[model samples]
Target chain A: MIKVRKLVKRFGLKTVLRGMDFSVESGEFVALIGPNGAGKTTFLRILASLARPSMGLVSVAGYQLPRQAADVRRRLGVVSHQPLLYVDLTAAENMTFYGRMYNLPNLNDRIDEVIELVGLTNRRNDLVRTYSRGMQQRLAIGRAVLHNPDVILFDEPYTGLDQDASAMLDEVLRTVAARGRTVVMTSHDLARTEDLATRFDVLSRGKIAASATHKDFGSGNLLSFYKGVLEEGRQN
Target chain B: MKKIIEDRSPLSLRERAEGEGKTPSGNYLRAIGAVAWKDLAAELRSKELLSAMLVFALLVIFIFNFALELDVKTRDSVTSGVLWVTFVFAGTLGLNRSMAIEKDRGCLDGLLLAPVDRSAIYFGKAISNLAFMLIVEIIVLPVYSLLYNTNLFQPGLLLIILLGSIGYTAVGTLLSAMSVQTRTRDVMLPILLFPIILPVVIAAIRASGAYLQNMPFDQILPWLNLLIVYDVIFIAVAFMVFDYVVEE
Candidate 1:
């Protein structure tokens, strides 16, 4: 569903993604794990067509990067550290606005479905500014999936959620995965992602140093595996 | 020969519909309308931006009253300049704050992700910004007329106002998108905007001044033409380049 070859992203004198090659098949839930400044979010932004790569051959759902960006955008959804929502608009209004942008058919029905899926049915009419951070994040999720995108990218979506909100988000993510869509999520919370993601990739120094499926670590410890990979990267 | 071939090319209705979702042009127009409606609706609910612009405009007029000492004869020469100056300053305030709100709220990124043509976003924002400025101008005109006892309601003056605003906002919207992304955004907008928009303001003041002073058609025609030319040139330039300005 997604492909990247020798992906290199540079900002002025600094380089963030360095010669990275990655691919994901349809319905694969990938947990892109990395420390700060390790280029996880940068990679996701490139996939979402929000940033152009300095050099790479990248494609999402068969559309080329930067050239077919509008086509790619129509097939993908993105949730960054910021919710990317208007705070003053109500939840339903936000969904309706995005609905129009995607030119969806029967938009009112889709808005209702996504709002209920996020469990914001009762609060849908309230202004987003009046909601808590968790509620806003939920609405962001609903907005992302409103048009039924083929791929969804989540960048640290649980950054500022409480315990209950985190649990709620987990259920929502599980539901999304069950629908068999391509999902790439970047997170610092390894424990939760370990249970959710089918594959785990450790990004270090702008490259994927280690990657393993859940079955590869069967009866083994993911924390120790991650630590060993980082230590190995440090030595090399 | 090329024109004949182009005209002879087949345009199957079903293929066009499939290529660009159902009713492509209609959907494009709807997207533009949706964006404008969202901005206007948010402004209506908050009233923060409009109120600030209105109060600042009235305050500027009051200061001008004290600073210029507009006794009957002097008022005739200076009222158009004062009103145009007031609109320019107040219009910048509105433009800067409007773009800043979108940036701070992450709405700009949200809009960028939309599948529609980027120019639709530009037109939507320009239209909304123009609406806000017009609302302020509409209210301020009568108030200024009453205070200075100058008939500011001339039909030609109104046309000039509309034309000048189109030129101001066409450029202002593009510049505001650039300025809001900079480090010193608050100070950046006026600095970037005023220099570029000087032609629009000058033509507007001159044409408006001529209209108010009951000048001959020959005297008024050039400034009016200048305003139209400025509006057309900038609107076309801004529309063509807006995609690059909003790129991350």
Candidate 2:
């Protein structure tokens, strides 16, 4: 679970997240949609213990962040826009490397399972540098869940992926949710998000402007809703 | 006094942790080992970092040979200093390249996501940088000896090189992690590292010069103490501040 109360993140004169409040319960698949510079990544980074909020209380999987971040990291898995894969390392090597870092048991077997899950088994021995963007994105997905974390955060994972790759990512997230892992993914792709997300929250101008369940979302009207939110945000 | 104690009690959690107390569940030794091993394995596969550092170090030594016009007398006197200077410069090269690889390729983010101690990443990189410096030193010592027919196999000199490399790499690793994040990147490493690590360079050179001169242990002891003091202080400082440097 992730809980954030009145979070405010600013860099000098610029405010990124302004007194925002949000939470994601266990096994929930929530899509965090926002425009560029709307602070979705900032919020996820804060929860990931990779960034400190300028002001707020944040607890991830019950460990308070910026204070008990190390404990929280044990339960948290993050996949950002960046693949975070070492280019020179083989897919197997990267997973083994991270497994050692997490001190995970049965390292080789875990690496195999995760690589297989990402559908990179055929190219597991090849350097990640040679992988396509889609392959790298899938590898990033594999790496994040390798530790079987309680909370997983993805920021703009759909960037630079083909349709098939996107579909593969959607299937992967569905499988992950079935295994009962909480996922908070941010994206601008409303259609893809609509397919994978059970719930959606609109972030505009550093605040949660609107939230709705997937059932409340009409597949035909979701794009119109997203456009309306953007128009309203721009007008303000 | 009572008011101050009340104000300080809660903040003591930070103070205690900073004082090297319990850090969640991870062992410092395991954390350090995991980090160092990852770096070493990665480098062994890529061979980019070590190769760049080795070639750069050799080039620096070669330039010094021509620039200083080292006759027989000056070569013996200046060899240790020259070798260390080369190591220091080349060490910076390797440190910058290593951290930059992590930053550019996003490996740093993956490492940060791991449940291990953040200091493990710091020490891991530091130890790997130290290893590279030592390996280069070992290779250079023989090359220098062969070039000038001077004996560099002295145990005392080897010890100085070890201490000096540790001090240099500890601070260099920390500063490189910071510098790589900035826009200036590789160019910024030496600018940030050299000034802060001046004490290490000074002590390393002096102690090395002393050993080469066959000076007594008493004469060389102060410089060694300086190295130890520097190693302790910066290692602590680097460990404490690593979280800030790596934060997104």
Candidate 3:
């Protein structure tokens, strides 16, 4: 349900994403793995309609990027490393506000359900500032899926989470993907991604260097495959 | 000619079926209100933005009181100018702080992700920034009156303050959105904002001065018109360019 071709992103003299192509089918959970500055976030932002590509043909759910961005945005849910939450407002308040923005129906019920899903029902009335990093991240997930969009882009959702938080997030991610939604998540944690994603796409030097299905690992695992791809990228 | 892309609603299919049945324009207005309400609620709770603006505004008036040891006549003549100056500086603080809150934790991105017109985000922020400026103005007028021993209660002057603030925050909101993406956003706002906001500042000062000095209605009319005109033009411009301004 997502397609990109010859995508190029540049900032003045620096070229970040060079003519790259990537695609994902419906209901596929894609884990985009790369090292720092490999443009994983940049690519996802372009798809999320948060950033425009310098040059590209990007479409999500049959809607074009940049041109049909608004329509694409309608089907898109995005969660970045930053919580994108108001610290001064309660979790419930944040959800309510975003719900109103989305013009969601029966928002109170949805907020309760999503808050419960994120396991923040008890703390829903508490200020986000009082919440821990993990709680904030969880609420961020709830905020992202509040609209129940067809596509969700998560960029390093596990960045600062503890082991327990990461584990909890894995469960949440599983639930989100289980709903038959298409998901694209970028991460450095290969093991976690290996467990969650149906496919792994290795992004290196602003291009998708290699891709494989979870089953393709066979006896080997994601780490070795990732390392192998990077080593190949370095050789080329 | 540029291609016109249709804006779409972000409501889920199921929710859209059971939803408010509001028209697109209705959704737009609600989104604007929702954004403005979000800002107001957060500020009301934290008082982080409002308190900082109030302290800075009060401090500016106090500093002016100590710095300008003018006789009653001179103080009256400069009252409008001083008030505009105070509003300008304090309004800058509010604008910067408002956008900073969004930028701090990627809340701006969150706002942008909404399926409404991007201008809704602009209008919403502009409205909230305007409210904060008006609130600060309401408090500052009394404090200025008590400190300088003059009445700032004139209807014409209050109108001028409102119009001036509408224009200030209109342009300031747009600039702050642009500046917030920069590294030195704190310094960037005023630098970008002050020069662009000159027409509003000058017009406000002149009209307010006319009101405070009890100038004839005819004498106040041109400055008054200028303030109104400036407000309309910039707000329109902000509406048109905000999508591009906040776009990366």
Candidate 2 residues B155-212, lDDT tens each? 8888888888888988988988889889998789889988998998999888988888
Error of 2 at B21 (Å): 20
Span of ten consecutive residues with least summed lDDT in model 2 chain B: B1-10
How high is the lDDT of residue A220 in model 2? 57
Which candidate has the highest lDDT of all? Answer: 3
Reference-based lDDT, residue B152, model 3:
94
Task: Give the per-residue lDDT digits (tens) of candidate 1, residues B138-224.
Answer: 999998988888888888889999999999999999999999999899899999999999988998998888887788989989998
lDDT of 3 by residue, A50-136 (tens): 888999899999998898887888788888889899999999999999999888877888888888888898999999999999999
Error of 1 at A31 (Å): 0.9
Question: What are the runs in model 2 whose C-alpha is more than 4 Å off?
Answer: A215-217, B1-27
The candidates' interface RMSDs, in order, read 12.5, 13.9, 9.4
Q: Which candidate do you rate higher for lDDT, 2 or 3?
A: 3
Task: Kindly indicate the candidate among 1 and 3 with the higher TM-score.
Answer: 3
Candidate ranking (DockQ, best to worst): 3, 1, 2
Which of the two, 1 or 3, has more lDDT?
A: 3
Off by over 4 Å in 3: B1-20
If scored against the real structure, what TM-score would every candidate get?
A: 0.94, 0.92, 0.96
